[model samples]
Target: MTTYTLNQENLNAISERVSTPKYNRTQLTTGIVHIGIGGFHRAHEAFYTDQLLHDTSITNWAICGVALLPHDTKIYQTLKAQDGLYTLMVKEFDGSLSKRVIGAITELLFAPEDPSKVIEKIASPEVKIVTLTITEGGYNYNEATGAFDDKNPSILYDIAHPTQPKTVFGYLTQALKLRQQKGLKGITIQSCDNIQGNGDMTKQMLLSYVKLADPALIPWIEQRVAFPNSMVDRITPATTAADIEQLKTEEGIVDAWPVVCEPFKQWVIEDQFSNGRPLWEVVGAQFVKDVEPYEKMKLSLLNAGHSVLGILGALVGYTTIDEAVNDKNIHAFLEHYLKQEVVPTLSDLENVDLEAYIASLLQRFGNVSIKDQIDRICSESSAKFPIFILPTVKANLKLSRQTELAAFVVAAWAIYSLGTNEKDEHLNIKDALKDTLHKQAELASQNHPEYFLEIESVFGNLKTSKPFVDAYVKAYKTITKEGVIIAVQNINLSQINSI
Candidate 1:
């Protein structure tokens, strides 16, 4: 019988002889608690933490992984089974692959299983920095207003009993409360999600929660916590059975929990740690005075670009980004959209070449081995579109020109909401807006494209802008009548020339 867990002997053997040199494990003097332990965290932040672990100078940065949802119990079990040993598969084009075993994680905790355990861990004096990848929706903000929805029952509960509620913000609030009561030094809360101004957003949500729960703690938290903005990128695909088989075949050891990612990775962080931080610069993490421009460039371009391909790929019946990007029409559509429509709106793109970045993004998209799924990318459109795509459209329209590429994205989303693809089959519409999308689709069929814009939470203040509304309506009409292929081919670029 084949074993599922990697025994200590196997782990030691693999660690000692793995092709990629294992970095020295930092001694555990201090703790870095990471919430939302998922594939992306394992593939991205943990990978960086592993690098820091290898650097002997940083001996205090140990990671204690926490999962809030019950489903995460399985992941916790898997990681525990292997003694927190997992292989990270770095995939490249031309069929090149490298596998490395990551071992930076020191312990795992489940929030629902033991909420007090989570609180104690977060409140511990040993824990200095708290990083999160709780996803876009995990913030539990109002989808329509893009603000903290105090009305949410969970939020309400957290307010009433701050320490007991099992939410990320609640956990942070309670932990901060403990810190205040104990006179312990404050910990930095680093947000690793793709939301624009993620750190600030996290702070706002936490502070808002605090205001309703314990107004007295507000000043203390404001004085202590440092919510530093950061920009992180990596293409870590969900693991599949084939990936497991490949690992077993290549390494001669069974790895139940392995992470797969594209070769491309980038992390830009603001150097604003409150308690302390790792010497991540030694492992290629860029620390800067201000990460705003970089964050905007990434959130608006790379993330927005991914959304475009994701929706377009679904329409074209392609599963992975590589499949969609390889199509000449899709590639051209994305290039024109990013270069002509998206890049021009950003006033502070810095010294980076926009054209080169788009080209490199396309190259990354075309990497078949990366296997980034369009469905995965499109999973949370309601949360993603407003943050990633709509901002660019608004910026482009404010310049007094309608961006056809931006319009294309809006239209593509509308078509995607229709509940069927070009193949006339049900397209799995995974989003918080699923129930209402069909209604919106019905409105679109009636040539009322503004119905989609009326989604106040996602479109926000931009829905009232005449230029944006008109252009979006026109694009929606075009897609509804002529379809995505012809609509994309016929976008008028000259309409958005003047600022």
Candidate 2:
């Protein structure tokens, strides 16, 4: 019944069983200040930075994670207790596992506890790169207008009390003000989210927020900060209790917060860091001239593919992504979706093979070892669908491309939002717009088939398009009449017939 607590001291002990940091943790310095540190950041960017620190003599690029929101308290305490040390367990598709203690995160700041400290850290001269992985919903921007929502309570609060800010924009504004006062060099604000033109989006929102909060700092922010667009990929699931137990039983390392992800990881950056960046390219990251194509490709293939499986998979009684992709009908529908609806929307990709990317996505989705929850992919999809799958639907319709599969995906989401499957069983839904969308879906599924599309914020006048309406209505009716499995099978058969 002996177990070792994961910390700086136990690293040497755990090194015998699993990988440990090869760098001296004491000499690490803060060069990158990351906001919204979550499972994705740990599994993706932190993993990459950890490799750089171990393989090279680089110690300045260490990350100081900002625990901003209230929910980040536990992670802050966990990491702080461990002296910013935690294990990263990579589960390969072939059923092999690799565990390593990530030492790249040398410092942790609970922004809620001390807002000024967080602002001071960002203003630090040594830190040149600030990154974010706050998910799709965290950007606090108007989806339809692509502008920052200054009306947000936290944002408003941060506007009034810049030194005691709550939101990311507020914190950035305050920190950048400090930098301007001291005449420090500019920094890069890289967004590692899944949004297309994420850098541009972040820049727009930040500038807009700056205009509202303090118009004077707007010019300084414009000149000082570099928002680099990036494409980050890895199927890192929220660490479950089972994962914690497995690590304890197998590796004998009891980490308070351990991150688990698939062996596959990729990061493509727009080479626009104002100050400087880590030599991440040496450790498998790409610094390209333009990240738009790569961003669109990842959003189209990997993100949308997850949804196609995640939403449909939920309706089909599959709890996990692999379970859904493994189903014969679901797999067929997904493959058709990738090559048919999603591919045509993608163009101008440089040296990137669409077919091979599609194949890799298919394989990645079926990574049973990762066990990425359908709920995880299905969560906050009101924010996700706008970026991930709907564009495919719009593009396909515009080009007269096949939207049968696209329609199926939307129809699947509509039904999935209802909190029940074909069996009328309770399904897990984690959407902020769940109550609203559920009511709309219920009404649409019952009488007014076009009613769900009435949510213009989401469907956005798709109800006005006759072709989309026809396909969506037909697919909606089909799924309700026959189950999800039969509905997808019918669409597949019809698609194959048309060709």
Candidate 3:
């Protein structure tokens, strides 16, 4: 067994089972600076860019990954050591797997190591795009006020000392300032996060930050920058130890931070960028005039569906998405929720088959080889609910639609937050709102369910509505008394009424 550590040196020696870059890696140069180099970006965006790079003519769209936080330190080191190469394993529904070495990332920068260098790279005339996968929570958004969090410690620090900054907002701000000072053109700040209006949100947040910290740059930014909304999709799981082991044994490739994703992928962009299009449509991206409809549809059905399985599945002792969605009753519950509670709100989309999309979501969620973790789906859920599930839930409530399924999912989240499953097994809950939700969950468990809904930012004013509150409390109690499987098995959700 001849195993090669994934790097520029091993590129030629990689097994015939794995695909390596066909073009000259030396010709590829970074024109895209993407922040938050998580598994999804590697699996989705970088994968697409790598595919697009197959045409040697498109060499400048290579990615320079920017890891901004302490957690990103590992990936930064791994990618830097590998010469921005990582093996991508694409798993299909029937359990088939294909591997490729994604060389679209030509450089990796840890911002904490030197923020100034990141700014310098972004300010370079060759770089015309800065992208982000900073999850919904990373926006530093206050949903209640519908604005960027002005008083956030990092935002404030960035405001005070624009030269040395902490957050993405600051890094972007300082970089643009450097560009502006040097008479360099603005870079399009595209956001590929799960947020509904991601590009718009990126623009709004940056504008708000600039108003507070660098008001003078506002006029220049308004004229030069482009923040195009986009809808990106791929079921990429965090690489587990098993994945690393499998890659090493099967393909003879030792990758430090390899990426694993389902074969399904989609990217819909608004066709607005200061930089010319990367011709990504050739590689299967939809460059459209509008991305909102796509965003709303995918977020409501796919993302919301993941949350349904993630929260409910966790409560039922299911550890991965396939295990949960593959279960007969839970699968039925998911279909019922999508067809009944989630579909009605997606009126904005045209020419799209909603039913087909729902069916595809089920297939994506049940991709066994991907082994997408329930904990990964549930992680950062506090930020996800507002972007993914709540809009559909709220829209249904406004129309007086049946929200029992959605309510049950939320109730399951409340129970799942308790850090213990029905089997008394410890649930490794990973949410920024864990502590607060746990406290609220305790209160809700003790008879005041509205206390949990009191977080106006997350749940909104849903606490004030009697019908929603009653449905929520009843579902919460049903999960508590009857357990999660029994609760989800009730497709009509009659079990919730038993309380």
Q: Residue-wise lDDT of candidate 1 within 221-262, one digit each (tens)?
A: 888899999999998888999999888876676888789998
Which residue pairs clash within candidate 3?
A: none
TM-score of each: 0.94, 0.98, 0.97
By TM-score, the better pick of 1 and 2 is 2
List candidate 1 stretches off by more than 4 Å. 1-4, 7-9, 16-27, 492-499
lDDT of 3: 0.86
Report lDDT (CA) for all predictions.
0.81, 0.86, 0.86
lDDT of 2 by residue, 315-334 (tens): 87788899999898889888
Best by TM-score: 2
For candidate 3, lDDT tens digit of each residue in 26-126? 98788899999989999988888998998547888889999998788888998999999999988877778888899899888999999999989999999
User: What TM-score would candidate 3 get against the native?
Assistant: 0.97
Which 10-residue window of candidate 2 scores lowest in summed lDDT?
141-150
TM-score of 2: 0.98
Give me the runs in candidate 2 sitting further than 4 Å from their true place. none
Estimate the overall C-alpha local distance difference test score of candidate 1.
0.81
lDDT of 1 at 420: 84
TM-score of 1: 0.94
